[model samples]
Target: MKEIQHRSDCPIAFSLDYLGDKWVLLILRDLIFTSKSSYGDFLNSNEKIATNILADRLKLLEANGFIKSSVSPEKKNKFIYNLTEKGIDLIPVIVELMIWGSKYDSYDVKDVVKKLGKDKEGTIRQLREKLSARINSDVPSNE
Candidate 1:
């Protein structure tokens, strides 16, 4: 991994240095909530991310340890992206964003966002557990 220079010592600044862009978080959202993995899947998102930017963000995310990519077992020519533990840990932050957006923006609160708004901690706990299980099960056992 390449070394990243931080603009400041603050934790938020450090995090923002990598994830400050809208596209980065949206890519993460798809990985966390949807069945998206391939480059094509991301390109087809409602946001209609440009090809060049999507490619750049995917490379950056993988380099920064938020995601890992593996060749799809069923389709040798294709790749699948999965969240790392660090990425999975960002669920709470994403949930908080959803809560904040729903509250302040005209965004319609979806079922998941409604749950998050109602019980933030509980909702985060449940999402983390589910994501953790999925990530762990996808890992091949050494044994």
Candidate 2:
């Protein structure tokens, strides 16, 4: 990973230095919520991200230890992307973003927000556990 120069010691600035781009968050959103794992799948998302941007974001995500890529077992030519533990730890951040957006954005997210009502912490815990289990199981053992 390349050394990133932080403008300040503040944590928010540090985080934004790596993840300030809209594309980065959106890609993370797809990984966390959807079953997207391939280059084509990301390209096909509704955001219509440019190929160059998608390629760049994927590389950056991988370089930053947030994601890992492996060749598909069934399809030798295809690659599958999975979240690392570091990435899994960001689930709560993503969920908080969702909650914030639902409240402020014009789009109707009432259904989703209603589902998350009053138990935000519990919801975060459940999502973390589920995703952690899935990610751990997907990793190959050294033994």
Candidate 3:
């Protein structure tokens, strides 16, 4: 991971230091909103991110504790990425961005956003729980 140079102690700046890049957020959006998890899945996103940038961002995300990766059981050469607790905490932020973008930025309203409109807290809670379950399920069992 590249060392972050904090310009100041402001909270937003600190966040930007980690998540300022559009690609970073997009990757997080894919992780949160879609079923995509593998490197090929990300490489094939609608945004058509370049391979090099995707590789760099994935490494940075893992290094910064937003995500973690493990070898794919079916494909030894591939990896499956999952959100850590820190990354799961960003679900609300992604939801707000989706809502704000749909309203002010002219982005299409996704189904989750529609649910959010009806019940913001409930929608976020459900998303968090779903993601937490995914993380828990990924853990290997001793038995």
List residue ranges in candidate 2 displaced over 4 A: 1-3, 138-143
Expressed as tens digits, the lDDT of each residue in 65-100 for candidate 1 is 888887777777777787888998898888778777
The sequence of per-residue lDDT tens digits that candidate 2 reaches over residues 4-115 is: 6789999999899878889989999888877887889999999999999898888888888888887777777877787888998998888888888887899877654666
Alpha-carbon RMSD, each predicted model: 3.0, 2.7, 2.7
Q: What is the lDDT of residue 108 in candidate 2?
A: 70
Candidate 1 error regions (>4 Å): 1-3, 138-143
Which residue runs of candidate 3 sit more than 4 Å off their true CA positions? 139-143
Clashing pairs in 2: none
**True-structure lDDT of candidate 2:** 0.81
Worst 10 residues of 3 by lDDT: 134-143
Tell me each candidate's TM-score.
0.87, 0.86, 0.92
Ranking by TM-score: 3, 1, 2
lDDT per residue (tens digit) for residues 33-108 in model 3: 8999989999999999999999999999998899988777787777888888999999988888888888975667
The predicted structure with the larger TM-score, 2 or 3, is: 3
Error of 1 at 2 (Å): 9.6
The Cα error of candidate 3 at residue 28, in Å, is 0.4
